[model samples]
Target: MSPMGIRLSPLGIGVFCLLGLGVLYHVYSGFLTWRFSFLLGSRTGDTVDLRELLAVSVKAAELGGVEVKAVRESNKLNENSKGKTREGADEKLTRGDLLSNKKMANLITSSFPGVQVNTEEHLSEEDKEAVYWNRGIPNEIKEIVKNPKFVSSESITIWIDPLDATHEYTENLVNYVTTMVCVAVNGKPIIGVIHKPFTGYTAWAMVDGGSNAKTRASYNDKTPTIIVSRSHSGAVKDVTRRSFGNQTKILSAGGSGYKVLSLLDVTGNDQETADVYIHDTYIKKWDICAGNAILSALGGHMTNLKGEDIIYTGSDGNEGGLLASIGMDHDALVEKLSSKITSK
Candidate 1:
């Protein structure tokens, strides 16, 4: 039959429609996969989860993978060569020491199988004893050990947990995997990272540091945006209104990683980029580490209310507060608002 004379059967038409639908579904699925893969791979997308990332990191480390390293014990050469030894370096306690000594290793091993726990040897018996008997360290002291880079600055205390929300992982196996990390100089966080594991969401920033601008610009349209915690809307509003004036527009966010990731959204297509200040009322060390890494790498500021730099591995692990900025006026902004924030 001539091409024009050939009449397609109803069965053929139905088959063709199914084929088209299948093709379309496949294409759509492929697109989503690509998008998710890209975001996860770059570690820059909003949907990325900090906890999951850390869990994966921990899992990889367990398998002898190199995605994550313990900051305290990993750099022994530098610690030894720098001649910077802690007070009881030889007699300091380690995470392993605490775990083994307190018989907590079995608990951690049972919860997170194959994951290695390495505690800093510099921690005094008191600190180790606390962590051993308490199951978790005080938030204040945990902040100090998380970020060791600021230990010498005398002004900075950086707290970082490549993985946060361990309880959630252990309890429900929920995707609420969070990485709690922050940098508090003078008892405040100038840089922070809060990453969610399941959703692939991340919040990161450098406050009062000149680095957040570039980092924000990379994810946003170069517009200054401040990220505030949804849970701390009142505190954020108070601080913003008092410091940036009531006219200052603030973006509300959830989780430390998500807040920082919002700043990285450069498109600015959404109303999320109306302003340029990212704020978190309260933050711990593990929630801000990776975020700090991103901000510092990008040239931003991360500090605490006292206008000090966040340090780590000190005898005392407490950091005062957290403050971050994405632009050049970070120091000026911190100085201006330092007096306004109520002491915690």
Candidate 2:
């Protein structure tokens, strides 16, 4: 009434102040509950939920695998040579690679809008569509881990190998082929999924979070079995001979993903098993990142030949060469072969 506004009496003003205080208290209580939830691993303020990411990655890998298998069954490779590898092996690409890459990229992009994705296939502008899949978390991974929240560094990077072992796939070595996906945070791989399209086998793991890869029954460390690339042997056989002696039982195979899965006792269409997987040439991160995460989850180690850890910073390649082992003493093995097997 004094300044063209209705005036409130003293009692009315007091009542208004009491109501404001009640609202403030309610808001403060809600904040406290949210803080408590964050501390208990239920809510992540800035951190991404690795469980959700893992589920999405599994779907992406499987979808990619479907495309790869369908193309192989249809017998339309449309293969083109992507030049030759340094080791003189024919580097090949096919229509299956592109289609698989597109499906995986679309699903991941739809689930995670702004996340950085690096894939092995070269895609056209028309292949970059975002397609969301309406599905819940996979039952196999629903209660796999106690705390599924990834509270570590928030900088996320996804690596995809749509059709690993493309040359082998073209040669009808379906056992060596795999579709792979890996999630690395702060240049460290924490989640991995490898799917074999031909055999319908999938192995996944999250660091500090469990893995479904079973241990091999015949893992002999005394005279360890080593697997090397058949296409790019390049002195690895000699290195194994020097390190583990002449009867070390060295097996040659294709596909980095297949070699890694062999360590996990995932014998594919054919029976293949190994205690160690070694590569002595430049290899891409997509080819090895999923294996790294899976091995890491199972208390194994995957590092460079010089006994150094490989940092996944979304680069094109790693020239340190590969040394991965399970159950065996990794440090001792590294010391033995680091001097022998080198990228030349």
- The per-residue C-alpha lDDT of model 2 at residue 38 equals 45
Steric overlap count per candidate: 95, 0
Residues 1-344 of candidate 1: C-alpha lDDT, one tens digit per residue: 65798887889999999999999999999999876554333223223222222333323212211111232224321221213222211222223222222222222233323222322222344433221111222343234334322122344343434333232333333333344444444554444444444443434444432232234443322334456654434465687677766755666654454444444543432224433344434444445544555556456555666656655434333245566555456677677677777634
List, residue by residue over 20-115, the lDDT tens digit for candidate 2: 999999999999998654432233555657887888899999999999999999999999988888887678999899899999988887667556
TM-score of each predicted structure versus truth: 0.42, 0.85
Worst 10 residues of 1 by lDDT: 60-69
Q: What is the C-alpha RMSD of each candidate to the true structure, in Å?
A: 20.1, 6.2
Instruction: Please report, in order, the local distance difference test score of every candidate based on alpha carbons.
Output: 0.42, 0.86
TM-score of 2: 0.85
Best by lDDT: 2
Clashing pairs in model 2? none
